[model samples]
Target: MAPFLTRLSGRAGFRLAAVSVTAMLALSSCGGSTSRSAPVLPDGADPHAPEVTEISALTFRAPIAAGIIQTSRGGADEEFGLNVTPQWIESSATAVSQIVAGDVQAAQSSYFGVIDAARQGIDVIIVSESYASNPGAASLESMPDSGITELKDLIGKKVAVVSLNSSHAVKIKDSLLDQGLDPAQVEFVELPYGQVPAALQQGTVDASSAQGATLAQVKDTLDTVTIFDYGDGKYNGMAESGWIMKKTFIEQNPNTVAAFQCALLKGTEQVKDEAVYAEILKTDLGFDDQAVASDIAPEFGATIRSEPLQLNADILKKIGSIDEDFDVASITLPTPDNCG
Candidate 1:
């Protein structure tokens, strides 16, 4: 509501310096052919002259990270002639900067981030769909005594969000509009997921939008009530985020993109198995018992669809996030046949 809030402070700093060191160590240990055995290739392929491609990817500490982690650990990447190394990133803004600077080739970004980037003349293509929200997967939360029992109660109240340009913010704003409430009446403050619970308890913000493990934490630790569910009503099964690459990078490295897509498809299928997903949460992401139990795994897929992305753009436009028209198809890559 604050002057068509697009860019919010405290959400764009780079955490790359520390992550780059770790990525370098991982690359050194994993890059040597002598340290690891020969990769298994498709039938009738030459192992001696394997056309392996190495790519560095940026990821967040969210449920979507599981697929890529499993892909690398499950040997899907190696099997597809790729050495995929993932670096944990702080935010989508940082990922965009890294991609443009050639520090990383690919990253997991929200649909809102992609649309906002396009409006700013930064060309990035969606290579694969990573996460779609399930019912009640994202929500607006407030303390029990906040007197905010319904959407209308939030008028003139401050709501904390990760970013004003985030998919969560757009969804919440759209929901407010659908309820016939003027979204500008409520103020959106930017806060990291880790600080949301504290901010709510300390009375810094009236309520906050939460998702994934953070949502699970607030429900467990605080006497909070969900004012609204972002996945409910007309927004059920909405595509939230996906893997993206610079348009020029995708054009120059078609085979690499295909391989990454194939491996991601295989990895997504693996996470659909409950046991496998739980293991990745406990072993890889370090989720506690409650966080793991309450985590609503997003609907993962590899194929990029135009409809959901177009819906996202429309919502952003309705909320006054972006003024220019965007063609969803222009930034989407065709799914590889093997991905199916």
Candidate 2:
């Protein structure tokens, strides 16, 4: 298993990315045509601690990212007089790497990202599960024009995964194995999420699977057939990514992470209300389509479940993607005091 994301190091990447994320959110929220200036980084004590007066979050502009954004609703942090300033990163790899470099204390990425980073000797932990994935949330789709009508068509063909050793790759391999196909037989190429649709159209990739914005963006595209979506039945209950932090962050600022988790869980529960659901959909989640937003809203309670974790670990072990001794219990990072 090779690393699939940008292995960013140092503070320079953090500075530029921090500013970029703020602007990126402003643009996305403003429909990309209009400009909205980001607020300046708030004055603070420890920039890394959410318990501080101001804290920064690093994220990609995707659905899992929305889980953290939901915590900002109703000014949860503001109610405590804490300001959360979000910074943007290009991919999950960057998001987690920046956390390791101490650029930001908290961020979210696929669970395997923590394992991958741990192999590199970077201590990290899952503070909470951020995204409880739906079965069809991510997929590998092929062009009907390319004669890739079945899962077996992917044998000896190129498949697109945004990164290797990523949850997308894990799911694709899981789907292939379930179909009784040998995953090693398929060639998986790294294609940016935005490019996979075009690659399918051009016949460069036999299939591609995507989640979050990419899935929503291309859900209606024609002439493509789904080859491997995280579901189609085999993988029904899997937790996708965690709201992660460097273990050092959790250790040094236990109360900070505790406060963060409490507010997050509270926010998580709040959105479940129908009235709050609609408001979050339009505001923090940024769904232009009311129906679609409601369809994709996250269930916070789902994150605390143990079944999906054991299921996820078992699948990865069978694929040789995770260590044979990988333990689901160990992967459940400790929660802060007073956190449910």
Best by lDDT: 1
Model 1 lDDT-worst window of ten: 1-10
Q: Give a tens-digit lDDT track for model 1, residues 237-305.
A: 677788888766765666677788888888777888888888878877778887888898877776677
Model 2: per-residue Cα lDDT over 1-340, one tens digit each = 1101223332355455445444434443332122212111122323224445555677554455554555665566554445555555545666666676687877767676555454434455666776666665566777667778777887899887766656778877777787788999989876666676677767777778766556655556644576665644655556776677766676666556666666566556655666666554455545677335525444344245666766766777778765554554454554333433
- TM of each candidate vs. truth: 0.83, 0.75
The local lDDT score (0 to 100) that residue 55 gets in candidate 2 is 54
For residue 165, what is the lDDT in candidate 1?
66
Model-by-model lDDT, in order?
Answer: 0.72, 0.59
Model 2 Cα shift for residue 315 (angstroms): 2.3
Cα displacement (angstroms), candidate 1, residue 78, comes to: 1.2
Clash count, predicted structure 1: 1
